[model samples]
Target chain A: MQGLAHQLIAGIATGGIYASVALALVMIYQSTHHLNFAQGEMATFSTYIALTLIQAGLPYWVAFLATLVISFGIGVFIERIMLRPMQNASVLANVGVFIGLLLVFRNAMGWIFDYTIKAFPTPFDTGTPLFGGLVSGHELGSTAVTLVVLGLVYVFFRFTKLGLGMRAAAFNASSSRLVGIRVGWMLALGWGLAAAIGAIAGIMIAPVVFLEPNMMLGILLYAFAGALLGGIDNPGGAVLGGFLVGIIENLGGAYLVGTELKLTLALGIIICVLLVRPTGLFGRVVQSRV
Target chain B: MDAGRDRIGTGIALPAAGAAERSAARPLRLLGLLGLVAVAAVLPPLFASSYQLFQLTLALIFAIAILGLNIVTGFNGQISLGHGAFYAVGAYATAIMMSHFDLPWWETLPVSALICAAFGFGIGFPALRLGGLYLALTTFSLAVAVPQILKYKGVEDWTGGVQGVFISKPDAPEGLGLDADQFLYLVVLAFAVAIFLLAHNLLHSRIGRAMRAIRDHSIAAEAMGMDIARIKTRTFALSAGITGLAGALSAIAIEFVAPDSFSVELSITLFVGLVVGGVGSIVGPLFGGVFAVFVPNLAESISRAAPGVIYGVILIFFLYLLPQGFAGFPQRIRALLRRRPEG
Candidate 1:
């Protein structure tokens, strides 16, 4: 019972990271109707940038902010340069471009940062457990950070004028453009915001997973499962789905399949959700006109 | 006839070949194919070194695999980023059969094909519900999970876990007057010729038209009384079986099978090969296979990370500039030539 509780808490902590990544995925899917297959790699690149800044003697928080800004710019740049031209291309072309980006970012990280795994320092590290030993200090701190980020995102989308415009553009680009929404720019902004969110997820998870080029692959799979489970198009549902996936992964790894098959477990979850309830728990049914 | 003569006087032929021209070209095309096959069967074994023969064998194997991918993704419009999983299954099946059951390498090919086809058929069921992006996502996850599944404890006895399974290379038969590498090359070439011929026939048949129709517009295809689901599922099975056969050949050629050998990267490479070779082009996968086999070595010679960077850049650029890939290059040339006369 005690072991299960510990696993549950750990799962929640990791789940927070997955939730953030899933949220980023949903943001892109909602806006562009295309999943950024490179999201995890891009986030990994941002985390590496943060590491470089910190290694160069910048404070942790400052490095974090700088990384976010850089990642945002990259997101916008990629949208304007690579994706905008590809908007009207075939599905294979679009997928090819995304896969290309994934390869570039992932390999670039290895080329620039090297493939050796490095310990990432946590600002919240306290060498002690918290909440009656239910979670470690870093885990608690990271979870809190994730919640704060999620809350801010919620506020932005729900209350801000720019957020409303972005939503309008995503919902119906032609109509939004007629209303002078600058739908193109709104789409760019969505990409930037998603990139920024991915950076946060990467930075938060780095300490636990360690900083490495391939570190995000498994997490990305889990995030995919979470996003699919929550509803690919629903941000809130994706967040909830992330937490659920994390818990399920943990409990299942411990009690059912064991750790070796955890990634496979993620695959199974994704396939099941896609097959049984593809719209997910919170997503709307989308109909294509013939 | 006067206009045709005048156009030829400008050193540029018309965009479409006349029926008479096509008929005149048919025998030449057949002769060219026969000559090419003869060259493939004869030149490498006779002139090339053993190492070169091995590399050529690898190219043929990848060509077969890329062709398999092309069948579904190119012809049927289903994007599978996980075909490597099928390849791995095929390779493992062959490995286990040869290493455990002591089956001849040729005998294991059919078993591997059947197993991979069943797997593809099962996967195709879920695929029926998912659209392009979702299917890509699902297949990509499958690719990512394959290595882990191969390493799982339950399958470790058969899979050999991290150590992997290995089988000895087959020797040349008595009185063949051939080395092992030469014999293997011929065997692989024969299989490649057979598979490519089958694929060509399949793609030209009524079923092939239905496959393309579905790819172009599913609803229209269905309205034409084509059974979309059946065609799709069968296409998936056919594709997987072809790719799996390549995997079996690879096992024989390489004489090794490890979990790590069939990583998600292999799938990506095969997809890259498909695109570069020209999707939906019967002869394109040959170029794709050669590119898959040779390009990495060229890239890696530059740097350890060069392969990925090169693949990424080439993929993006090719999509932008050469969407039809190398197979379309000749058509592009003809189009340009025709445009010159107009200008």
Candidate 2:
């Protein structure tokens, strides 16, 4: 029982990170209908920036906030410069560009930061165990940070006028244009927000995974499984799905396939969800007229 | 058949060659082809070292792999970021057959092709339901997971685990009066020629028309009574089989198979080749293969990070500026020349 509880706590902590990244994915898919294949790489770049900032002695929270802003600007810049021209292009073109960005970001990070893995500093104290050793201090603190970010995002979308305008633009670009919303800017904002959220996820998970160019690849896969599971289009459902996938990954890794096959387990979940319930647990069936 | 041709004309119509012009060019075209073949056959042995021959053989192998990718992504409109998975499967199948079963290397190709085709068919079934982005996502995950799966303990005996499997390289026949490197080069060239011809024939056939029809517009094709699911699944199988054959060839050429060699990077490299060579063009894979094999070495010579940087920049630039790739360059030039005279 104790072991199961420990696993569950650990899973939730990791799942919280996945949930954040999944939300970021959903945000982009909601607007552009294009999966940002470079999302993971972008987040990794942001985390590296955070590491650089801290190393230069900018306090933790200050560095974190600055990284988020810089990441947002980078996201918007990429959309405006690279993706905007390909808006009317084929699926292959869009995918090809995303892949290009992925390679550029991954290799650029390797070049700049070097491939050696570095230990990331966590804001939370690592010396203490919380809740009778069920969870570590970093796990608890990171989960709290993730939840706060998720809540802020939910509130922004639910309450803010800018968020409402972004939603309207995504839901119907033509209609939103008639109603005087800048549809193009909304898409860029969506990219920025997604990038920022991804930054949070990257930073939160960095303590556990360590900081490296390839750190987010497996987590990205897990996040994909989560987003797909909750429905690619549903933000709330994706978050729930992300947490569920985290729990499943932890338990499955522990009891079923062992640690070596955890990635395979994530792949299986993605395929199964896509095959059995592609719209996901909470997704609406989208219809198109020929 | 005429109607199908007309439909394809509406899709990506090449400038129609008049019968008289075609006849006039036929012998010249054949002579050119023969000249090219003769050069391919003799140039490596006469002017190049054994190492150069090996590199040329690897380039031919990559061309085969890129051609397979083009069949699905370029012609059939299915984005497979995981063709490396098929390539890996093909390699393993060949390795296991040669090392475990003590089978001759030539015999392993067909078995590798069959296994990869079946694997492709299986993956294709689910693909029938998934659209572009979803399929890309699924395949990407498959690519990411493949290395891990190869290292799993369950299949370690057959796979040889992380250390990987190796087989002895085949030598030339005694009567051929050729060394091992030259023989392997010729053997690979022969296979490359045969496969390229087969692909050319396949893409120009009725089934090829059907595949293109589906790619251009699935709904219209379905209305025309085409079995969308079956054609797609079979196309996937065919594509996978071709790539797997390339993998088998690569295994023989390199004399080894390791999980690390078939990383997602290989799939991306093949994709880069397809884009650079020109998608949906019969001759493009040759250019793509050369780019795939040679460009990285060129980039690496500059710096450690140069390859990925070069590949990324070139990929984006080509997508934006030369979407038709190198294979389409001649037609593009012709169009430009004709337009300049008119303007």
Docking class of 2: medium
| Candidate 2 interface RMSD (Å) | 1.0
DockQ for every model comes to: 0.78, 0.79
State the lDDT of candidate 2 residue by residue for A1-290, as single tens digits: 99999999899999999999999989989888888888999999999999999999999999999999999999999999999999999989999999899889999998899999999999998887778888999999999999999999999999999999999998999999999999999999999999999999999999999999999999999999999999999999999999999999999998899999998988899889977998999999999887
Give the alpha carbon lDDT tens digit for every residue of A92-112 in model 1: 998899999998888888888
Which residue segments of model 2 deviate by more than 4 Å?
B1-20
lDDT of 1 by residue, B295-333 (tens): 999999887888998999998989999997998788799
Each model's lDDT comes to 0.90, 0.90
Who wins the TM-score comparison? 2
What's the residue-level lDDT of B337 in candidate 1?
100
Clashing pairs in 1: none
Give the docking tier of candidate 1: medium
The lDDT, on a scale of 0 to 1, for candidate 1 is: 0.90
Chain B TM-score in each of the candidates: 0.93, 0.94
